[model samples]
Target chain A: EPEVTQTPSHQVTQMGQEVILRCVPISNHLYFYWYRQILGQKVEFLVSFYNNEISEKSEIFDDQFSVERPDGSNFTLKIRSTKLEDSAMYFCASSGGWSYNSPLHFGNGTRLTVT
Target chain B: TQLLEQSPQFLSIQEGENLTVYCNSSSVFSSLQWYRQEPGEGPVLLVTVVTGGEVKKLKRLTFQFGDARKDSSLHITAAQPGDTGLYLCAGASIQGAQKLVFGQGTRLTINP
Candidate 1:
């Protein structure tokens, strides 16, 4: 079965550096989302994108964070300036629709570590 | 903000034992979903319950959505060691956008 795939399973960057996390969602899926899980914390929604624009975002997704579908298959999340609190497992997900019943398919995730 | 609270943050039981996990919220949801996550992996959807008071069974696992759509539960009968993992519940709000609000998760250990 097709699945979402994320690159750079582990990422380590300096506190002030910029970093980009990449994911390739399921080919046929339309809605895309980004969620992050701090160690031992509940998974938190970062942003959702559809029709090439951001549909929703959480407070955690502040000025430093941005998402883009640079091409047909690649969706990227970039942090302009990384912070220690930004370290977490970032997951990319997609679903066929935006309806309540549309189950999301998630990627294994990219572990981001800021020092 | 919508929140899902899962009971019994951690559970340990021997193989073949039965167990249940509960997810509760004051706010109603349009749908509720259950997921399982192994170490270092993203959550994988196990089941989705849309209608209120609905019940769905997946093999030895059963899921039920509350009549008010504010709660749900997962019951595992004769759980095996393979069933041990982090179980998470997420809900989709009726008014909010498509983003899901997740519970803190329950860590289960089924010792064989």
Candidate 2:
């Protein structure tokens, strides 16, 4: 089955360093999103991208966080400065449309560890 | 802000047992979705319920959406070891932005 793919299954970075997580959503999907799950915590929404722009973002997606669709197939989330609290599993998801009925397809996720 | 509260954060049952997990919220939703996640992996979509009081069955698993669209439940009959996973429920507002508000999740362990 066609699925969303994320690169760098696991990453370890120093605090204050910049990190970029990459994702390739389903080819035909139009809406893309980034979500994070802290250890022992609920999955939290970060941002949503569509038409090369961000549609919505949460408080957790502050000044240090940004998303880009640099190419037709690649969507990336960059953190300007990593922190200890930034350690989490980041998941990329996509959907065909914006309707409530559209189901989200998610990638395996990238584990980010900041020390 | 919308929030989904799941009950019985953890459950452990033996093979051939029956169990039910619930998702509740005070805010009405346009749709509700259920997902299952294993250790160190992302969530996999199980089912999506759109209309109120809708019921869908997938083999031994049955899903029901409340008539008010603010709650849902998942019931598993004769659950096996394969049913062990973290189950999460999410809801989307009637405005239809496609943003999901997720519940804390229920960790179930089915021992064979």
Best by lDDT: 1
As for candidate 1, its clashing pairs are none
In angstroms, give how far residue A36 of model 1 lies from its true place.
0.3
Chain B, candidate 2: TM?
A: 0.96
Which lDDT tens digits does candidate 1 get at residues A1-115?
9999999999999999999999999999999999999998999999999999999999999999999999999999999999999999999999998886677899999999999
**Top-DockQ structure, candidate number:** 2
What lDDT score is found at residue A98 in candidate 1? 85
DockQ of each: 0.70, 0.77
Q: lDDT tens string, model 1, B1-112?
A: 8889998899999999999999999999989999999987889999988899999999999999999999999999999999999999999886434689999999999999
The TM-score of candidate 2 is 0.97
Complex DockQ, candidate 2: 0.77
lDDT of each: 0.94, 0.94
